[model samples]
Target chain A: MKSLQEQIAGLDDVLSARLGGTAVSLQPIPGSVPVIQVVIGGREELPIFITASETQVLCICYLWSDEEVRADKRAELLETLLALNPSIPLSAFGRIDKRFVLFGALASDARVEDVAQDVIALSDNALDALEALSAYLV
Target chain B: MSVIGKILTLVRGSAREIGESVVDANATRIYEQEIVDARNAIMKAKSELTGVMAKEMQSAREIERLRKEMIRLENLAVEALDKGEDALAEEVAGKVAACEAELEEQSRAHANYALQVGKLKELIKAAEGKVREHEREVAMARTTESVYRATRSISDNIGATGSKLVSARESLERIKRRHEDLADRMAAAEALDKETSTRGLEQRLAEAGIGGDAERRRATMERIRARQAAAHKDA
Candidate 1:
């Protein structure tokens, strides 16, 4: 599995490129979870979640901007990043075999343990699922 | 009334799946009971049929005995007539005819009882068939109820989570906006105070009439005013 630092770096690059003129930042949460911040149209910084393990990786994006347009932009950035890299399998990172759950939401708890088991299990990552979210940005 | 009801209407349908789940559950139970009742009825009917069959067999045996008695009486009548006893012969003949008629009636009664027993057996078999049919229906209903319940639960959870997330985000944004507004007001107030102070300083300098002139000219003007005032005092 990619280390939290490496994944954050990759995310920073991907988000920065996809959203020009937007400053993006990534920090590792206390427990090796990577938290991403993307400046939406230079207006608001949106936070997203990415979890990686040996066998699975999950990503969830939350809308942080209060303005509708900035929210839209943040959503677009999320969609683009997900489309470009998709969710990388933790097994591909070597030696990580546990399930990784990624949930994107700023107001709601991003903590996986608090969420319902079925919801986490339903979370899936694919290039296509990311692309499919693009239409929802507006 | 519940979120689940609204969601069910949207996805499954208003009239169909919503009520169908409960209906199906109840139907499943009812059919289950129906199957049990049907089996019981069939069992009772079978028992009744068995009893009727046994009674009919007994009646048939009685009819057979009567038939043999009639045959023996006819034989005695013929023997009596051959011996040339007219009165005795007449009496024997009458007894033989009466016995034959009675046996015939008994045979008819046996046939009727056998028919009734056969019909009862058919009814019992039909009831058993119905029990099997009811069992199949109950199974189907149970499967449908389980599927519906699962679907409803999933939808309810999704709706609950989605609304909760949205509400949390709205509240956070509200708090952040309030903070920003307070900060903006404070910045604007500080700027206004600075502007007011700068304007007061400009008014003071203008009243001294030393505002916006060449530095040397203002100093010279001040020196002349001071000397003229001193000379007037000496005079």
Candidate 2:
């Protein structure tokens, strides 16, 4: 099988059909690794970033940054995220320094539909996370 | 520490400071090497399992040879007894007993080797699974660095001039606006319903100085004043 990066890079027309009505599009972000930014139809505000190595396919959707977070509600927001993590399924809350993100990983050999599902789920989860935690933002 | 462990530690120290350095290059390399080590461990176990399997085959062969020898000796003992050679029969019987004991020992050895083979194979299988998981973690950690750079650049671009990526606040703003719109729509619907009702028509007529509550109130006020004047005159 091709690397997940390449496979995701080629996920243009099929995932949209898989999603039924929601359009799915991908852009190959040029960098050190093969990272593709996927913007699903309904969740256009949240674009998922995916890249794969020999062993794993990782997808991440950034929710917000610390700078965006209100200082007074920071603790409350962190607590909310931790409390909500397990229930969200498939994805976990993580912070990339200042950026808060929801990340999910799967084996590199997963099918394209599986990857699409992961991306969709992650994107949905990200939007929910943002909306639920919006009060914490500046 | 694992890359994830390192990230958690850094995050705990100060989430703000844990940005691009969550899994440094060295930590990532170390993590990749751990996958290599796990694979090597599985290979060693496989080799050991092979050795155990070989020992089991040899022990099985030993047991088979002993059983054949025992069968031959028993036949000889029976023949000696039939030919009126009691002492020869006793000697053959003793050799047969010795063969039985050795056969029992070989069987036990083979069983132990078989058990070890099963255990080693299971261990190797589990180790391989662990290695695959670790490899996945390393892949994610490495890819995350690229993500880190990309997001950093995005953040910079947004700060310099807004990008296509809408902020969370913007989405929230839209959501709030929708709620406000719903409130406004509800109020407008109520007003429209009232405007088309019979009561609304009466109120509009009164306000327009047509014969309604306004004229009746004016006549009642005049009658009250006349009654007050008649009472004053009688006083």
Per-residue lDDT tens digits for candidate 1, residues A1-138, read: 445355344455455554553455554433222332222222232233344433223344333222322354665654554554435432011001111113422112222332222122222222223233333333
Lowest summed lDDT window (length 10), candidate 1 chain A: A91-100
Query: In model 2 chain B, which range of ten residues has the least summed lDDT?
Result: B10-19
Q: How far is candidate 1 from the true structure (C-alpha RMSD, Å)?
A: 23.3
Highest lDDT scorer = 2
lDDT of 1 at A64: 21
Models 1 onward score TM values of 0.37, 0.59
Q: Which candidate's TM-score is highest?
A: 2
**lDDT of each residue in B1-235, candidate 2, tens digit only:** 6657744565465533333565677867886788888788888998898899999999999998998999999999999999999999999999999999999999999999999998998888888888877776665555555555555544554465556556778865664576578789999999988777967778789898887678899999999999999999999
Predicted complex 2: DockQ: 0.24
Error of 2 at B193 (Å): 22
